[model samples]
Target: MQPFELVTVKDVPEAIRAQAASETAQQGATVRFIAGGTNLVDYMKLNVETPRQLVDINGLPLNLIEPLPNGGLRIGALARNSEVANNKLVQERYPVLSQALLAGASTQLRNMATTAGNLLQKTRCMYYRDIAYGCNKRQPGTGCSAIDGQNRMLAILGTSEKCIASNPSDQNVALVALEAEIHITGPKGERTVPISRFYLLPGNAPERETLLDPGDLVTAITLPPVPTGAKSLYLKLRDRASYEFALASAAIVVKRQGTRIDHVRIALGGVGAVPWRSLEAEAALHGKEATAANFRAAAEAALRKAHPQTQNGFKIELAKRCLTHALTQAVA
Candidate 1:
């Protein structure tokens, strides 16, 4: 990694001031925030990220994991993945999130990775990592090499002609399924963003990943209360059992009333430019019978608009089976 000025901040406002000087939150941001440094360091080592200044927010008071007054959960931005996953409240109430955390990197990574770092995790696309290749995400307007190159592990759902890199975070997939809200503090003031509006599709600007501005510091994420009979789980399908990213993974929360499905929230990872929340799949399952056929139909509805690349056409069916089986187990 190249030489960079590191500034440690004790509060959110200080961190915001340090980062707000950046022009954009795009790939070439000269100033950036660093918490866990697990993902950012990897890119820095590859020279994929060349930030001139690093705002370290580790000393900030943002590591709390507690219950909200409304019976929901508030996960601080700096909360360790292992701490959140093993917490009694998270294990019992948000098992899908817990499972996804455990399904992420490895035990060592889980212990070090923070909530905000996972929130802003970058893709594992090979083309984007290697500077020799042309990647719109890495260097905008140069062209995406993965469009016709090695892209078996890239995205299929949120593909534009410019980019097809998959979102590679298990924690985010579970967050999208739970309809969590992101709390942020920036130069202007504070704001709350719904999970649906958090990430941007790689339509024209693959360089800009999330809605985060240059100075925006993620404070915490709030998850609303789960429904009464809601059953949640995470299922990850990968080439290996550990130390590998998901090929297709599902985070499902299902609630059944008698024989009819009342509540359903579906989010898939390793399949889209973002942690994909399948409203179409949820629509198919709402008030429907919890039968194998219904689950199959819902899975089909989820992948109806998939735009598979040359080598990744199998991901469409693989994602479908992954979601269907996850839904089945969630309801059962």
Candidate 2:
């Protein structure tokens, strides 16, 4: 890591002022906001991300987890992952989210990682992390080495000629399934963006990951109310049992009326460049009987557009099975 100036701010306005002043002094300077530093510090050690100025926003009043008037949940960006997962409201109302959070890193790391940091986490692509290799994400227009290199763990969906890195966040997959909204604060003011539209695909510019601007800071995320008696589950298929990224993961929320499905939401992880919401799969299962046959059909519909590479062709079938198992568990 390079030598940088660390400025701690007590409030949001002060943090914004520090970031704005730094940007004004040095045009095109990398000024990053640090909360838990679980991801940023690791990237800094590898020299993948070298910001000259670090604005610590841990002291800001953004750590509250509250219930909205509409029966929804409001999660502050600064709230730790463990804190959110262990909260009684989250564990009871949105068990899928809690399960996803628990499926992530170890307990120590989860206690240090923040909600916003988890959402903004980068890919685990080997080529992108190592500076020796050429990566479009790390260096634009340099070419992506993962295209023809070791890409067994890369994305199978939402891939372009430029890059094929997968999104590696379990919590993000659940958020996408729940149709959560991200609340962002910037120099201009505040705005809300849906999680589905927050992440961008690796079309031509793999460098730009999220819709967040230069000075934008995520404040909170809001999840709409889940239907009464709705059941949800998160299933992850990885190389190991603990402390591993998923090779194929599914988050399913389903509401059943006797044997028929009332409503369903599905999202996939570790298979796409962004957290993939499977609307096609949901359409196939809605109003249909919650049986093994319907689950198989929905799984097929979810992975119909998948385009696998040389070494990762097995992911297509694995993701389908994972989704099917999650749906079956949710309805059972």
Winning candidate number (TM-score): 1
lDDT of 1 by residue, 1-332 (tens): 88999989888888988998987655467988998899999999999988899998999999999998888999999999999999999988899999999998989999989999999999999999999999999888999999889999999998899999999999999999999999999987999999999999999999888888878889999999899879999999999999899999999999999999999999999999999999999999999999999999999999999999999999999999999999888877
Per-residue lDDT for 44 in model 2? Answer: 89
Q: Highest lDDT: which candidate?
A: 1
Residue 217 CA error for candidate 2 (Å)?
A: 0.7
- Residue pairs in candidate 1 whose N, alpha carbon or C atoms collide under 3 angstroms: none
The lDDT values for all models are 0.93, 0.91
Candidate 2 TM-score over all chains jointly: 0.97
The TM-scores, one per candidate, come to 0.99, 0.97
Query: Which regions of candidate 1 fall more than 4 Å away from where they truly are?
Result: none
lDDT of 2 by residue, 144-257 (tens): 999889989999889899999999999999999888999998888889999988999989988888887767889999999999989888999999999999999999889999
lDDT of 2: 0.91
